[model samples]
Target: MDNHTTIAAYNLAKSAYANYGVDTDKVLETLDNISISLHCWQADDVGDFETKSSSMGGGIQVTGNYPGKANTIEEMRADLEKVLSLLPGKHKLNLHTIYGEFNGEAVDRDQIEVKHFQGWIDWAKKNNVGIDFNASCFSHPYAEDGFTLSSKNPEIRSFWIEHVKRCREISNEIGKQLGTPCIHNTWIPDGSKDTCVDRLGHRTLLKEALDEIFEVEYDTNYMKDAVESKLFGIGSESMVVGSYDFYLGYAIKNNKLICLDNGHFHPTEQVGDKISSVIQYVDEVLLHMTRGVRWDSDHVVTVNDESLLIAQEVIRSGALDRTHVGLDFFDASINRIGAYVTGCRASRKAFLFALLEPTELIKAHEDKGENFERMFLLEQLKTLPWGAVWDFYCLQQQTALDNEVIALVNDYEQAELLERGEVLV
Candidate 1:
């Protein structure tokens, strides 16, 4: 749509929302300030630039051989820059420790340092973006036994503990250099595939390792810590060492942020419900937004019911300021850049729908115990002209509209991705 039509539609939307006491201008202003961190793994399908990299193990897997998978540091950065250009609003980049530029050196996980990621820090600075970090404790020979920090073998466990410690240090440096508090999230794939005879023993080991890793506290101005839990993974169907209960207690006791991955829960469980509950105890929470299909499949996010509910809960609970939003999914089967743009755009639309809600008015009805009125207003809201307001926002931000994204992605794929080289199998 052209700017004239978009503005016209937005005017009508603005007038419609005015009757409900919602200011579209204020909503757009607030939406512009919300930054969604884009995961780097999506560009290359989680194939990091490690010299001695091992095959994806410890329950992690990626399934596709699309052409133009970022096989080098330069290619990955270029693809990420393209993704940024197509997205609206300010955003941060989420990086795993394995994505660091090692210059073809044998930099083991335990030996990685800020020097390894200096290139990424410089690139982020030039592009005007902040960075978040993750300590990759999987896809290594040591993690082949389906345990890292919670491993019964002390040698294997210590390696991962040291790796996480270094990652935290690197994250702090990145934040300090960029003038933002980098959130360092730790997620380990420690679990049992079958009935475990020593559940308590593994949990105890994980706790000890975490305690030791976090012994050196960094300034919050430059860094914050979060622990992520998973229900189960490919090799951890029976028992996951870092369950939600374990991380919840650990985060509360240690005054750390708890990561709520929407895909890391039971298929029937709603992560949106847990957000309100977790924030009552912790000062802040990290949200890894992704979709799951019957399991933790890590599908690209769309503006589905679950996504809308999650955004609504964040707005309804008044936790916008206390929550950090980040994307966490990879789909190499399609155009990688298209996947990134689609996921980011869909996520923003969900939040836009939430922000456009007449929340105060609806809550007033509920507060008065007017159940029928509240239900009616909610059902009516489903038909609101929120998409018109969204189109206007996209125009204002100079991004591709919903209708223009596919053609732009196709042009790039033909001119860039297809020319890169042969397809990977």
Candidate 2:
């Protein structure tokens, strides 16, 4: 907990890892370069400040009645400021189209433009962080039927196409202003609750709509496009128009980045294994780190085996430069700030654990056909002084070490969030 104790422990850890040919300093440096994008919706439970919807009509759901949820753009930004301060290194923020500032004026999805989000861009500039954008194709009147780009009606499909095009333009502007290429991700809740005979028809329309939406050329240096797929949703239990195969093939053909949401696949599918296979063919990929309990529940992430494997696959495959990692889980059941800090820290810890592994040693054994020895070394590396190294990293960052972060969150809730009472527009 103290500086001397932490320094001594780190020294011991450095020596222990040296025996395995591992460099603790190099691991800390590498971890510092990795920026995990924090999702903005987590602070507000997906309820945008601009809308007054009694119910979020999207197939997705954020089930919890937690107090102190952000109800205004100012509140959301303030909460995020606290979150960023609590985190280590630099990071980016993921923003949805609905989270724009319109000065309390009504702005429809179809009518959104760069002006609506200039405040966010300016905020990012002041904070010295990058911004990512997503088009809100759900929770609107147009998406009530669980379809957007794939809608049979020409008017409905065309509206969404225009909206996505504007979002891309906004993303390009954000990246141009921030000097970092923004990843513009697209996701639509288009599917059927029951088995439909028109599955092929929907996919066909979706492809045509996407082709039209991506017709305008934007500089890849400013922004890149990514398509996200989901297995199914609450109402769309039977079929999802943009299935994994559909987007995977589309991404390969169009040279676009494919987003792999951890909660979007079947229970048994290892998203980690898919990473190596995807990067071999695609130029780059985006990852939405989430936890799926039986299905795509979007619970807060933990330092579990799934996360460890995912981090290992990325590190072992040497795909860090090509992968854009971001947090995507939202749980209104717990403290909003707590959820953000917990998920982001868990991800960093996973990466840290993977970085501490004696990977080269294991790989050398495998190359020599010593399979059992490789497995034994991997199992043994799990019990090393990785925790001490992590503590040292936290100490160096001047952040709360271990469970101390919980106390910080609780103090903020009591001193600030609870006294705020009702949120104003």
Candidate 3:
């Protein structure tokens, strides 16, 4: 799409939206301020730079091994740079503790420090992006039993507690240096695969561990903490220690952020519905946007109904400023960079579509009990020319348009990914 054609289409869209009292200009402006955090694990299929022999546990799995997995710190950084270039808005990078630059040394999770991630900090500064940190509690020997913070073994639990404390400290430093508060999220795969009678015991231990880990306070300006819950994973079918109820109560009591992952709930559960409810209690909430095919499959996100509803709810609840949006999925069956671009773009497009909605008009009708009118307007919104506005936003941001993404990704794959020689059959 040329500049002239984009501008003409956007002018039409702007005019059309004005009839419904929605300002296209203001929508675009709001979209510009929204930043999505790109998960670093996508580049390497959750295989970090650590020199350990631990296999992926905790019900976390990555499927399809497309060629060109980043095996080194430099390669991961380069891949992230490429992904940023393809995205439209300024975004942050989310890093797991395992992805730290270990410099060919064996640094256990509990032994990691700020120096190991100084390289990443410098790189983030160079790219003009902020960083979010995660404690890699899974895929370690201590977590093989599907427990970390909630482990019954005192030694194992203490190790994970130490690791999480270090992660928070590192996150604080990263935010202090970059002048953007780093959101450090903690998620563990602690659950029982079969029926268990000791659920309360595990929850008690987990709560104690968290209280101890968070005992040391850091400046909120530099770091904000969030706890993520999972419905059930492969080994955690019977029960999960950090269930949504547990975390919600913990967050509300502690005045901390609660992370609501789209793929972390039952199939019938809608994370969007929980957004408005959760925000009323917590000061802010973190969102991990992903697609789950019948389970927590961690598939790349798409601009589907669920995605749209999540964005719509965020906007409708007037919690846009209080929500921290981030992407979480690992689909190695396709090109890694393509996954990043596709998922990130889909998320942004969902938000863009939500912003383009005539929300005020619809809400006014609902307020007056005009159900038919509200339903009709919402149906009509599905066919609006929001795509034109989206294209113009992409044009303004100087990013690849939807039609051009395939060719761009293919070109990069041929030049970079195929040359890595780590093709998975």
Candidate 4:
């Protein structure tokens, strides 16, 4: 779309929204300020720049072998820069512990330090972006037994606890250097394949391990801690140690941020519904947006009913400041950069859709018991020119609009990704 056509369409959209007392300018400003953290693993299919690549385990797997996976830190950073250029607003990068730079030296998780990630901090500072960190508990020999932070074996449990503690320290340093509170999230893959008889024992061990890990205090201005839970995974289909109830209870009692992964709940359990309820208890929340077809597959996010509801709840509850959005998917079936752009674009669109909603009018009707008017108004809103506003956003941000982004991805693939000399397709 040309600039003139986009401007004309946006003027129409702006007027249409004004009729419903919605301020398009305010919505655009809000969207501009909102930053979603893009996952780094998406570039290399979760394969990090470590000295040795461990086999995927702990119920996490990235299928397909679409080529152009980044083999070095330089390549990964180059790919990420290209992705950022195609995105609308400024966003942060979420890094797994495995992606730390070790200068061709073998550094195990337990011995990792902030020095290993100094390069990343410098890169982020140069790019003017914030950073979020995660403790990689999977794809390790210790985690192959299907337990970490909740292992009955004291040696194994202590190793992971120390690893997590080090990760928090690293996050704190990164945040202090970058002048943003880095969110350090911990997710464990502890569970049983078959029906485990000693569920209580595992939960008790997990609680003890977490208590030890959180004993060290760090400045909240530098970093905030969060715990993530899952209902089940590939190997642990029977029971998961870090169930939703466990994390909810722990987060509430410990005053920690609770991470609600979209794909980590039962099919019937809506994450959006849980948002309002959880915010009432916890101080803040971190959302890992992904799609689950039949189980927790971690597919790329789409602008679907569930995503809309999640965005609506976040906006309606007035918790935008307290909530953090992050992407969590590794689809190697298509262009990796395309997957990143698609998921991030869908997330922003969802937020834009929510922001364009006439929530105040609908709430007024509900308060006055005008159910039919509320329903009609909401239905009418579905026909609004949100696409025009979105295109305007892309135009203002100098990113490709609609299908045009595909051409950018194709151009990058031809010029950069394919030239990396590791094309799988």
Q: What is the lDDT of every predicted structure here?
A: 0.92, 0.90, 0.93, 0.92
Q: Which stretches of candidate 1 lie over 4 Å from their true place?
A: none
Model 2 poorest ten-residue lDDT run: 49-58
Residues 126-221 of candidate 3: C-alpha lDDT, one tens digit per residue: 999999999998888899888899999999999999999999999999999999999999999999999979999999999999999999999999
Q: What residue runs in model 2 are displaced by over 4 Å at the alpha carbon?
A: 51-54, 422-425
Better of 1 and 3 by lDDT: 3
TM-score for candidate 1, residues paired by index: 0.99
TM-score of each: 0.99, 0.97, 0.99, 0.98
lDDT accuracy of residue 81 in candidate 1: 93
The digit string of per-residue lDDT tens for model 2 on 135-169 reads 99988888888889999999999999999999999
RMSD (CA, Å), each prediction: 0.9, 1.7, 0.9, 1.2
| Weakest 10 consecutive residues of candidate 4 by summed lDDT | 416-425
lDDT of 2 at 84: 89
Query: Which regions of candidate 4 fall more than 4 Å away from where they truly are?
Result: 421-425
Global CA lDDT computed for model 1:
0.92
